[model samples]
Target: MGELDTFTDALDYPVYVVTTAAGERMAGCLVGFASQCSMDPPRFMVWLSKANRTYRVARDASHLAVHTLRDDQRDTAELFGGRTGDEIDKFEHIGWRWPTAAGAATAPVLDDVSAWFLGRVEGRVDGGDHVGFLLSPVAESPAGPVRPPLLLLSDVVDLSPGHPA
Candidate 1:
């Protein structure tokens, strides 16, 4: 083996919540393993840990909603990132609403988001610990009047998982 990098070191990137509108609302922890993969076609990719409950829901989701948190929205990040939706209804506590885009799924759009994008899952590929989802943006918008600083991995250091890994 070459070497093993600590997950902490490997995960030091902007965190986000990847959500889906299947039967029920679901969301999960996503480190910075996402990026704009295309320009002309307008595509983005997000990698969700296979071990995550959100991935299970997302696998069947028609649309995945991507939300960026404001620095003040760390609480929201912690709830989604550190906890599993398998045992809890995260939407109960978060302020959210459904998108108006045509053919939009039942995913929740965080009300306090800094920015958001609703993408259709164009493709999916297994990436070992995580599954990579290629999303083609169909709808997007800024969340609030004031742009907020994005919450990063460094901001949510104290939160621990509420579900068994």
Candidate 2:
């Protein structure tokens, strides 16, 4: 409706599925707003919608797993972006695991992805309607010889948000 909105609407970035765990509770959401913010310490930031279920669970989570959706993972995108976790148990339907490191169990990690990383939450930044979770990548999944193209926001723009943002 405004110039700022128009500028943002023209932007397209890779989509990500961010998952977090708090005790036995787990939550994940499709995220379009994220980027590598720093190079020195290798920091990645993910903005979680305040209204999304994942934001609530991630509030107290120590770590999070970021899954980069592949070009063919539209179904996976739909499941996370279109369904509300407040009404359903998405994990029960998705194939995920708590990627272990030094036998230290962590959050739910999506099984199939172009790439995923486990990160320790270093800080949080409030961004009006959303919150940015600053991450320090601890472990990354094995990279494939042929890296698949990442799924972009335009690929899932038709999807309505599971929770109002």
Candidate 3:
């Protein structure tokens, strides 16, 4: 392995489930490559693989709902990460809903998650096989009284992704 690979090997980043919609189409996927990229302007970036169906929908999506996962939510992770959207309807298996507020975009918010936020897509950056979606937080779900420990990469290292990254 290279030096960069060795460096990243020691890190365990938090896992997130990002959901978005365009017209009648909606998609969500397990994401490990995302972070808060800006502080002053408050921007978050999520990297989606070009091969995933979510990427196709996100291309025309105006907003995305990013959900935080907990250690106990491994089953949810498996559903999103292990099954491809091309083969099945993931939403039918999970509890989710469209934003009810007036003039809200059709981003699907996941239920029973640790926390979540709605972000308007600001821009897109082509990063080889992955495209980074720059987001500015427009809304957020109310925080639960207690915050649980987050699910990490190390916890799902053995999972086979639904689609090749």
Give the better candidate number (1 or 2) by TM-score: 2
Per residue, candidate 1 scores C-alpha lDDT tens digits across 1-165 of 325556446665677877786775466554557888899989999988777778888888878888887778878877787777777788887888788873555566877777889888999999878888999988887446776678887788667865433
**Regarding lDDT, does 1 or 2 come out ahead?**
2
Q: Candidate 3, residues 1-165: lDDT per residue as tens digits?
A: 665898899999999999999998999999999999999899999999999999999999999889999889999999988888999999999999776651565699998799888889999999989999999998788878898999999999899999998
The sequence of per-residue lDDT tens digits that candidate 2 reaches over residues 34-135 is 999999999999999999999999998998899998999999999999998999998888788878761476678888888999989999999989999999
lDDT of 3: 0.91
Q: Report how far residue 154 has shifted in candidate 1, in Å.
A: 1.0
Model 1, TM vs. native = 0.85
- CA shift at 18, candidate 1, in angstroms? 1.3
User: Per-prediction TM-score, please?
Assistant: 0.85, 0.96, 0.95
Q: Which runs in model 2 stand beyond 4 Å of their true positions? A: none
* Model 1 spans > 4 angstroms off: 1-12, 28-30, 143-146, 163-165
For model 2, which pairs clash? none
